[model samples]
Target: MSAKVSPSPPLYTTFLVYCALQVAFVSFLFSYYDIEVGPIIQPVVKWVIEKAEEIPLVKRTFELLRTLVIGDEVNEENTKTLKKSTPKQKEATVEVHPLDADLSYLPVFSSEQLSFFDGSRPSKDVCLALLGRVYNVQKGHKHYAPGGGYHFFAGRDATRAFVTGDFTEAGLIDDVSGLSHQDILGIQEWSNFYEKEYKLVGLLQGTYYDAEGHLTERMREVIGLIEDAKLWKAAQTKEAEVFPPCNSEWHKDSGGRVWCTTKSGGIHREWAGVPRKLFNPGTKTSRCACVKNFGPPLSNYADVDEEGTRGDLDNPNLREYPGCSPTSNSCKLQED
Candidate 1:
């Protein structure tokens, strides 16, 4: 008999060889392709699925199946979740009060970005809107009263206004407008906070609020002093410049920490109790004579007294770490 044709090379074996070739081809493509195939393929599949979801029949089928399996459980869970969530609007529609002329053009810093509220009346609306924006709570009689309370997690003016108003109502604040020298410094200390962290550098560059406006003078002075001394410039020389938009190019450590620098023969250094030294890039240390004596302290965010001695409130400076204030001693700066 003629040698039986080799049964078409055995369909099973042929199929296995075909599969192996396919796998090899894919491996080769992965090794040789310059373009990123993973990202390209994933998005393409994702877009196709998204497009398919828009079809009426496909959407209906998905909803029907979804309802069939866990409809009641999902419905109950959704109701419970809704009950726990605050009924805050994304943006406030309330009219701003006219008396807050200077407080208009209020800015909300969120997601590391700024959102400005522009309208005829920005004070009430801005403050009220911030209550919802920061705490996710809308304004109402309950929110206005003591028990309703507020949240200042944003730590920006929007949050500060809410905290100031809340504290004033709580009788914790005697004067919102007439802060003393100590209070001004204490306020400066508190201003260093970013929600709950010891940011080190970001706080000095951030904008703080002043309901009574006393803090404004001190803040301007500090800003001017630091700018005049080219503290930021010096800091930039030590680290990479990572200042935010609308902010000047300034040094930020890898941990998102920033430092404020000043050059005024280092006079402000004594008042603030910060030590200055020649930066040591190799060891990431400071050689300034003052650093050794003053301990090269980071700034604190504490509640302040009229004399500027650090104090505490429901909120403390450097929320993550309590009892860590800026180094208490002062010293003269040394030249590089």
Candidate 2:
């Protein structure tokens, strides 16, 4: 007997079977990975779903599959609920001013309360007050703790001792009543230094600040004095630039010699000037300064004309050395 011949399936039928197997494999992979196929296959899936919805039999089959897989009907309300339940990651926000600490939330500290943070107890922090502003100096515990060099300043507002070099119990008081304007300015500088180096925790209730952390009248007056001192310092700096201090050197056997240089007194200039004794008004005290000899004065004066060529040499405040030449840029001093 001849062997029976088997007929092959149609091309369309073979293609459909292959496609169904591929889709089943892809669906298994997606389900195992828990992947959201909506975004990856949105366009193709949407078009297929739309066409399937147009056919009553295909639409009913899809509804049956959806109910079996998701335990819900495919509708707009259910889709929105699914999206709402999805997890999302949040991004961190950054501060606009990272260095500036908001001090308004800090509490006002009384003198007795501030004394508790003096590092005497193991649980307490090392603290000190400058101009009524309290700072946590725990990082410098070796210097601010008990038996330390600066331990005396740790528990109190001893701003006066910063400039006076008086570390005695009586001299460590915060009252700056008899201090000069320069000393007040010195206290302000110490406050600035503490603000930069440590954390400001609170305000003290005496002298500079009130119980409510408001500035007292005495503090305002001190601020005004600081401003005036700054102006006076600026004028003195300008005067030094115009009339740079003369370079001086002395030896036991050779006496002394004062000279001028282009870079004398740490002030750089194009001219190496002549040395002269600059006198302070209403005082016999004098110091040597380098004065320009061939140009107009660096500063304006009521008695001297701007068009003069004598520089600052013609000013009444300056006098030539007794033994030195009037045009020389150096002077040899003779021991009296």
Candidate 3:
């Protein structure tokens, strides 16, 4: 056993030998890999950390942008003044007019369709045309009026039929006969027929009554009043004494205008019709009044009440100032 003894390898020499073998093995195995080692590259991971820290600021910026876009700020200043400073410009101007007396006499007619008409006895065609005009006027043909101020009606028969039609259309009024208090009130809202405050021009009852015997004085006076208003000539001789009255107010305000006037505990109930003219023709241009009459040949001495009460209309007692029982049907029909 002691005949052949080999010497041990040195620590430095052995380490060098092991490193050489490892290098040779790695070179042979990694021959296809692109391996180049120089200095270490600085990591980009810090940039990600910095971006995460700015998230809150980004969200706050977005919130501020949203508020500005939505106009949610309470301290909104005068934007008009601010916008004027911008590149955009604004113009200021005013219209002018003259006050000549000749210009003042300009015709009262308007291109805008009229709800009023002088045709006291309107035919079906006239009514249809008038209604179409009214509808167009209301539907924005002109900016001239604040619609619903007037109504247009045909003859009495048409008016009566329209009364039924109104209830059928609106289901508001049940009775067509004008005798019921509710029916009379409902008739006031009618736009196709004149209400209680507007004026109407037509013939009046004569001595020959339809329901009862004629009162001689009443007929003559009515004829005289009609003639004075200049509406009688247009009527035919054989025409029923029941021609339409001309230009009388439907109702009156407290100031005697064509507006409703109501009193408590009075017979007026909710309203009463007022004749706009009785004594003069040109007193109130906007509103027409009743006409005066004379006797024998229709003069101003017919004893007709200037206040539009019927010839035989009973005066209400002081206690019953607002109440009256129409004794004579003729008295009620006079105003109708």
Which number leads on lDDT? 2
Model 1 clash number: 11
Candidate with best TM-score:
2
Note the clash tally of each candidate. 11, 0, 34
- Candidate RMSDs in Å, in order, are 24.8, 9.6, 24.9
| Model 3 misplaced stretches (Cα beyond 4 Å) | 1-160, 164-179, 191-336
lDDT of 3 by residue, 1-336 (tens): 568755554664455444434443343233324354223311232233234234554335435544654453333444765666677555543222111111222222221222233133233112211111112222221231323222323211222334444423233222233233333333333532331222222111221121222224433443344344344333321111211123213334321112212321122222232222222233333222121121121122344355543421221211111122322111111221
What residue pairs clash in candidate 2, if any at all? none
Mind giving the per-residue lDDT tens digits that candidate 2 earns over 126-163?
Answer: 99988777889999999999999899899789989998
- Please provide TM-scores, in order, for all candidate models, with all chains considered together: 0.18, 0.66, 0.15
Q: Write the per-residue lDDT of candidate 1 for residues 1-336, one digit (tens) a residue.
A: 787555563584456445444443453345444445587565654454355455555446546644644566678889999988958667733333221123323433433332221111224221222211222122332443324443222222343332344544243322224433333334334433321222111111132324331224544454444343355456543332111111112234422222233322332333222222333344465432222122222322343233333322111211111222345223322222
Residue 16 local lDDT, model 1 = 44
Model 3, residue 99: distance off in Å is 32
